[model samples]
Target: MDQDGRDQNFSAASQVNGDHVEVVVTGEVDMSTADALFRAATPDGVHCATLDLSAVTFFDSAAIHAVIRLADRYPGALEVRPSPQVLRVLEISGLAGQPWLKPPS
Candidate 1:
């Protein structure tokens, strides 16, 4: 799909509470959608960012890198609520249970 088509299928929204921001993401998170997810999860000046990926259906290395970059930008400030698929990716990438990652319950 084209960029517009991919964007229409994948969406991210953030809700800020005090110094924390919860970013809710829905749809596939591949190379085409990773940037938008990263942007939504890593907003400027937010002390903490919580990425809610409960609705995410697919993800790849691009999505993993996006999360890694976000963690690099703000260490110990990112909480990730991963879907089962995303959780598998994180586990395989050796990012699960890291200080920067909050695995799904």
Candidate 2:
């Protein structure tokens, strides 16, 4: 699919609450959509305090890289709840137990 077409399969939204922002993401998370995920998770140069990816259906290494970069940018300041799909990729990458990652709620 074209970039626009691929983009349509993914979405990320950020909600600010007090001192932190919660970023919610859904749909396929591949190379084509990882950038958008990063942008939504980090707004105004601040990494989001929480990442909600429970609705993500297709997760890839690119998405893992994006998430890792986000965590690296803020260390313990970030927490992520991942979908099973995202979790699988994290497990394969040996990043599933990282402190910043949490099981889905």
Candidate 3:
């Protein structure tokens, strides 16, 4: 865990698997919390970054921007599995259609 991971308001954990990394996120993600998501989404030399937002309970536009920033930073290496709440926001923000954002199965 990095310093950013220590944020008590938000919790993010990352696991590296070969060329890919999976980041699990929970709690609210807003302007104040998006930085943690951004830090968690960092590729850190991995070819792929997957954001597991299955536990996210709340999010805002900043959360959407955090995902977009990850996409811009990593190009086609970003994948997102958003929770129901996060999914609604992503859909409203139109980020759900991005090629980098994998649709929930």
* Backbone atom clashes (below 3 Å) for every candidate: 0, 0, 0
Against the true structure, what is each candidate's TM-score? 0.86, 0.88, 0.83
Compose the digit string of candidate 1's lDDT tens values, residues 1-105.
564566666889998888788989998999988998888876667888888888888989999989888888778888788889888888888778778656655
* Global local distance difference test of model 2: 0.84
Q: Pairing residues by index, what is the TM-score of model 2?
A: 0.88
Candidate whose lDDT is highest: 2
Best by TM-score: 2
CA error at residue 1 for candidate 3, angstroms: 19
lDDT of each: 0.83, 0.84, 0.81
The better candidate by TM-score, 1 or 2, is 2
Better of 2 and 3 by TM-score: 2
